[model samples]
Target: MQEFALIMAGILLAGAPLVLATLGETITEKAGVINLSLDGTMLLAAMASFALASATGSAWTGALGGMAVGAAVASVLGLTNIYLGQSQLAVGFILTLLTRDLAYFLGHSYSRQPGPSLGYWGIPGLSETPLLDLLLGRQSPVVSISLAAIALCWWWMYKTNAGMRLRAVGESPRAAFGRGIRVRFSRLMACLAGGALVGLAGAAYSLAVKPGWGRPQGCEGAGWIALAIVIFGGWHPVRAAIGAYFFAALQVSGIYLQDIFPSIPAQVFQVAPFPMMIVTLLAVNLGRVGFVQDLMRRYPFLKRFSGSWPITAPAALGQDFDPKKGL
Candidate 1:
């Protein structure tokens, strides 16, 4: 039982970044902005946060700096795409490459160096509890923040008027504008906010989960996994978080399996999650194909799962919002 608890905690720790990043993207897409620069943004933020933290010897300050970097990148993407009438996809893709290379170049000095890790602060009584102790006792503040983000985002999106406006802008900007909502401004804000969250995720990686900076570039493909999780989760915060945890569990399982079967190469386990995610991604879209649709129809029981297999994306995602079209 203790071992199981430890494994679950490990999964949560490893999955925190994914949870935060996926939720951030969900918020961005919900507000009608698609930021494809997630991978690069995270990498850059990780390096920047590590450097800042090392310089100041303060984790919180470093996290704030990371958020600023993320928000700045996101703001540029949002403004250029929304106000300047550029293609969001093109701009995002370009920014991804640019930010990634920039991180490598600028972070040359900070790479592979030791820095301060985030401090763990468990709740008083909760930290001493049975299973909870193992689960939450030694967790960093970022883990709690990530979990809280999920709940807060879920509430803000489903239960608030401001959230409704956010959805309105994404789903039908023309209608939202007609209703007197500032569609462009709303989307711009969403992108900035989402980027901040993504930045926090990056910082969490270096300062807590993975620790230290540089070589191995462990965080490289995390952004892509988070994005895939958003799709698998149907853009819902809770569902997306669940997907993140599942993926993390898969990763953990791979590592454990390698120890049990020494004959199997360690690289196989390390790379297993990528292909698994790809297969899951394909499964999510299977509803769109004819054969899968036919199978779903023939096997009534399959409908329980298949009906929601391919979740529909937000109506206006990835499109440039034209003011003239709305007016």
Candidate 2:
């Protein structure tokens, strides 16, 4: 039992970066924009954070630097999509490729270099507690931030007026505008806020989780995984956080399974989580089919569990909002 608890704790620590990234994208999408440059953004932010941290000798400064990189990229995305009325998908894809190449090129000098790191710190009194200490008291600030972000985002999205306006914009910008919300401004703010979180996730990887910068950074595909997790989580902060933890568990299990099955190829274990997540995503979608809806309708008791059902995307997710066009 003790070992299991430790393993779960490790999973939460390891999954912190993904949780941040997923939550960031969730917020971006909730504001009716899709910042698809997450993969490249994370890579560039990781490199920037490591390089800055190495130079300045402060992990927190590096984190801020990384967030700036992410916010800058998101700003470009917002400018093109919201102001210029360009296609969000096209611009996002371009940015992803651009930022990715930029990271590889600019980060050549800092590859594998030693840098300042965010170390584990235990909360004073809480660290003395038993199970709670193992689960939450002793961990890096990055982990704590990820956990806090989940709660804060959930509350902001569901309990605050600003959050309601943000959601209203995503659901139907025209309708939201009609109701006195400033759609474009709200979206831009969400972009900046979400981008900062995404960037922080990258910093978390380089400064805490993996603790350095290098080609392949072991975080190459994490952004994409985070994106999928946002969908798997149905765009809800808490659910999305759970999805991050689930994937983290898969990754940790793969490490254990490798030792138990020495004869099996290690690469198989490494790539297993991707395909498994894909399958889970497919199953979630399958539950939304017509027949499934019929069954839910036939049995009203199932409605009690409706909160668990996967949600569809926002009505204005990828569409450009132009006030001049008048809805």
Candidate 3:
């Protein structure tokens, strides 16, 4: 039972950051802004938070710094794509490279040093539950905070008036503007908020997961996993959190079943999630084609995936100030 407890704790630790980032990304995508710089955001935030904590001995200060860096990086992307009318995909991809290189260069000094990790704080009554104590009971405040945040996010997106405006911007920017929605500003703010959330996820990794200072790869492909989870989750915060946990459990499965599957290379299981994600994308997207649609309708399961598979926003929200279109 103690061993099981430890493993569950490890899984929670692995999942917390993913949950935070995925939820944030889900919100951004829903608001008609796709900040694909999640990798660099996590990488830079991890380095900044670690370095700040190391230098100042305050994890909170480190987290703030991390958030600032992520927002700044994301704001640049917002400007290039949302303001300058550049290809959103190109801007985000470039920002990912740029911020990662910046993190690498700026954070190399702290790579070898150890830093502070966040402490866990279980909820009062719930933490004491017997079997639950092993899994959700010993969760860090970050986990509880993340869960609460996702719930609130879910509520805000699905229940509020602002959410309706945001959805209108995503669905049809011109129509939204015709209805007086401040599309560009809304999308930009959403991007900044999402980027900040991703940065928080990075802080979770630095101060909570590894509890150490390191370089760029310290984030170690977490952002890509998060981006993948965003798609797998269909851009929903609650669903995204669940996907993160699923991924974490899948990773933990390889460890728990190590002796059980001695002959099956562990690397195979580790890389298996990527292939599964690809299959998911293909199944959802290709199902829109004629023959694919026929096959998907026949399959029933693929019918559930009838939504956009885009990686970036189609327009700058409702700020369609295009002179060519007589805006």
Q: Kindly give the stretch of ten consecutive residues in candidate 3 with the minimal lDDT sum.
A: 311-320
Clash number for candidate 2: 0
Candidate 2 to truth, TM: 0.95
Which residue pairs does candidate 1 place in steric collision? none
Predictions in order: lDDT: 0.88, 0.91, 0.76
- Considering TM-score, which of the candidate structures 1 and 3 is the better prediction for this target? 1
Q: Per-residue CA lDDT of candidate 1, range 1-327, in tens? A: 888988988898889988999999999999878899999999888889989999999988888888888898999899899999898889998988998898888889987888898878777887557788888877788778878999999999999999999999989888888999988899999999999989988888888888878865678989888889999998888899989988999999998898899998899999999999889888787787898779878887877887654487889888767777646
Q: Return the number of clashes found in candidate 3.
A: 0
Off by over 4 Å in 3: 1-8, 215-218, 263-266, 280-286, 296-327
Q: Tell me each candidate's TM-score.
A: 0.96, 0.95, 0.86
- What is the lDDT, from 0 to 100, of the residue 61 in candidate 2? 95
Which model, 1 or 2, shows the larger lDDT? 2
Cα lDDT tens digits for candidate 2, 1-327:
667878888998889999999999999999999999999999999999999999999999999999999999999999889999898889988998999999999999989888899988787787566777887777888988999999999999999999999999999999999998999999999999999999999999999999998877988999999999999998899999999999999999999999999999999999999999989887777667788779889997876665466578888888888899895
Q: The CA-based lDDT of model 3 is what? A: 0.76
